[model samples]
Target chain A: MRYLLLVYAAAEEAAALDTRLALELAERGGLLAAHELEPVTTATSVRVRGAATLVADGPFAETCERLGGVYVVDLESLDEAIAVAARLPAARDGVVEIRPVVRREG
Target chain B: MSSVATVFREEFGRSVAVLARTLGDLDLAEDAVQDAFATAVERWPRDGAPANPGAWILATARNRAIDRIRRDRTLAGKRELLARLEREAPPAPADDDALPDERLALVFACCHPALAVDAQVALTLRLLGGLTTEEVARAFLVPEATMAQRLVRAKKKVRAAGIPIRVPPPEALPDRLRAVHATLYLVFNQGYGPPPRDELCDEAIRLTRLLAVLLPDEPETLGLAALTLLHDARRAARLDAHGDLVLLEDQDRSLWDEARIAEGRRLLDRALALCRPGPYQVQAAIASLHSDPEPDRRRIAALYDRLAELAPSPVVELNRAVAVALAEGPSTGLALLDALAEELDGYHLLHAARADLLRRLDRPGEAGEAYRRALALAPSEPERRFLAGRLHELPNGG
Candidate 1:
């Protein structure tokens, strides 16, 4: 199984992922990919209508917590994914959303 | 109990857990288990009960699930599962005793932290408790459709979020088990009043027993078993002949279930021997003390103090005040209650306790006011009547 951990943080707070935890996850072959996203100011939202494509600036929603980073990990279960997410430094000061990665082939 | 109902209670969780482990799908496993029970409910009486009910149900459920997969071969994402299930060995005989008791795994998955507490409870009841959606709704005092939706949503989350059906590792065991215990405790508490829902309490205690056995060394598990058993032992004595709520002080001690109390004490002793005193163990200790012919008030008060320290809740504080009043004096308890007046302003029991203490202290007027507040805030007719009866006994008809 695989999960995408979407890290969210306030605009002013720089959410830092723990390097040791990230290294351990990678070493254990659980961490597939990890990256910090550009701030919400650099986000571009797009919507497709029947014939028109509407483009907007900033993140998708005007919320205090903005999407800051993401970690894609292959794990045994959602609980394991959550355990990994909870070890992240940002989890203490922000929120981490876990979404299962759809498997095209088993 | 009817043989069918008895079989369902004993075998549902085991069958579903084994099925889910083999099938890798909680939703399918639950549906299959339900189908198996429905079949048993219809057939067992006419066909005569099977020798080994659990094995009978498991074999039947596995066969039906395979048949369903064969019938619905067009469904997407099931082809792989169907192939895998087909490659497995043929179904065993009904009397086969090799059925894996994986109910603890099922319980853990149902009580997963990702789900909301209510959802966890509903799922546990509907799946592990062998309860129908309507029965679960009635237990929770919600509409059937609401509970149905909740079950569907919870099952969907269990699938979509990939919450695996298995026991947690050692490090996560305590926290995960705590969640499981909370749901069971809630089920028992919900069964506290109504006779019709008393089965919920029985089911909760039954599951707690299973947990204690499956994880024999977890002192908290043992403590929870002790707590539920101890509380249940006093169920028969909680109300008077007039169907009125009986206060602990006024209840007939002879009515208590001595056997259950003895078993609870044994469990508590085991928990204490572990030297890992948690909230449930502390509360169970208090209940154990209360079960005594002449309860040691000071010891009970000391246990309450430990409980307050462990849990740190206003309700615990309130109980501690009562225990303190029992051990020390009403005036001391009254002083403690005064400190919590602001925090527990709306709690009826707080007012009731205050009223009791004031009445004992001979402050009839203050006691009258507190009794009136408690009466006004009382949630049920029995509680209101109990408070009113207390007031009626007061001087000047307070």
Candidate 2:
């Protein structure tokens, strides 16, 4: 099973992270297949209509924290995924929300 | 009260859940079960613990339900609902089968996300912990009416939204469990921290123990229990004879509860052995570092670094700032705390940390500003006073 780990953080705090070291740790743990997003200056959320995506300036839900990054991790079970998730530097007081990715045309 | 009444009260929850399953309407199920228990309490002393106590309760409940259905003119349309309930609620052979999923169902139902966070906590404590609204209110330092309204509204939302009474599917369990664990943690934290209400702390511990029992296989659950125990182990040492905030490093090592710390450490080790790293497990790992008699700030800083990466947030960063202060120096931590202040404007601990860092840097003016901010945002009397005391040390504290 594959899960998406959403990393949330304040912008400055996100900037101070040891991205290289984090990636190294993830790679050693086989969680390296995940992608790193460029820190976004702007975020626009969209909802699809009949033929259009209605874009808005931030997320659909506004929170103090923003989605700092995301990781697409493959693991055998939620337990294993959680283990990997726990190791992510992002799971402290800030949360790393883990949701299973839904496959289209599976 | 008689033995039957005691039994009825003890089994009230199981009876309610069983009845709810049979009746398919929570309100009706609750009334009928209460009526059954009432009858049992009145008759059981005279009748003795029935050969099958469940059957006696079920029989009484069914008959009472039937009478209510027949008597309520407006509920004539609900005859099918009533009949179905009565049919399903047959006399139990032993009553042991009555609530197979009673505790679980109640917990899940109470923890439904449709309700607000406060509502979830209040409802869970009420339904599973068997606590009254007044008791919960007192535990939370809120008024009974406020808590009562919160529970009432929560139940209404659960019924109105048709929230199911089952633990979410495997995929959904993590998030749901997070919420449930959070509510439980909050309860425990409330108990273990300020006001020093030992009973509420014990109640929260009891509730978490139940959760630990239910989800023994989940390392996160065990982690939560362990984290609670670890923090709780030092509860007595957190305050002094003068009732001041005692920093972890400054706390008297002898005052810490070795037994509780040992249990917590064991649970944390077991959780780590499972290699299932979730939020709770990560938090537990942090707590485990603190549980040491002579905690290594560098090791704790490394764990915080991993934790900050695993769960990046302002709060984590704030914690890492403290760890950095310990592992590196107050100056190194000051930079991190300053950066955190931009986004964590209203967070009390951020200001407190900033103040501490400033004080260490000998920047008295800035430290006073930070202390004022902390005092402004402090959530409790003790915290406010502590911040105020820190400010008093600053030149011309305004």
DockQ of each: 0.52, 0.02
For every model in order, the fraction of real contacts preserved is 0.58, 0.00
RMSD of each: 2.5, 12.3
lDDT tens readout by residue for model 1, B1-398: 24987677778888888888777787788888888888988898899887777777887888888877778745446777777666765446543556677888999999998999999999898888878899999988899999999999999899878898888999998899899999999888888863426788898999999889988899999999999999999888888787788878788889999999999999999999999989999999999988888899999999999999999999999999999999999999999999999999999999999999999999999999999999998888888988999999999888
Candidate 2 overall lDDT versus native: 0.72
Alpha carbon lDDT of each predicted model: 0.87, 0.72
Output the worst ten-in-a-row residue range by lDDT, candidate 2 chain B: B1-10
Candidate whose TM-score is highest: 1
Considering only N, C-alpha and C atoms within 3 Å, which residue pairs clash in candidate 1?
none
- lDDT of residue B368 for candidate 1: 97
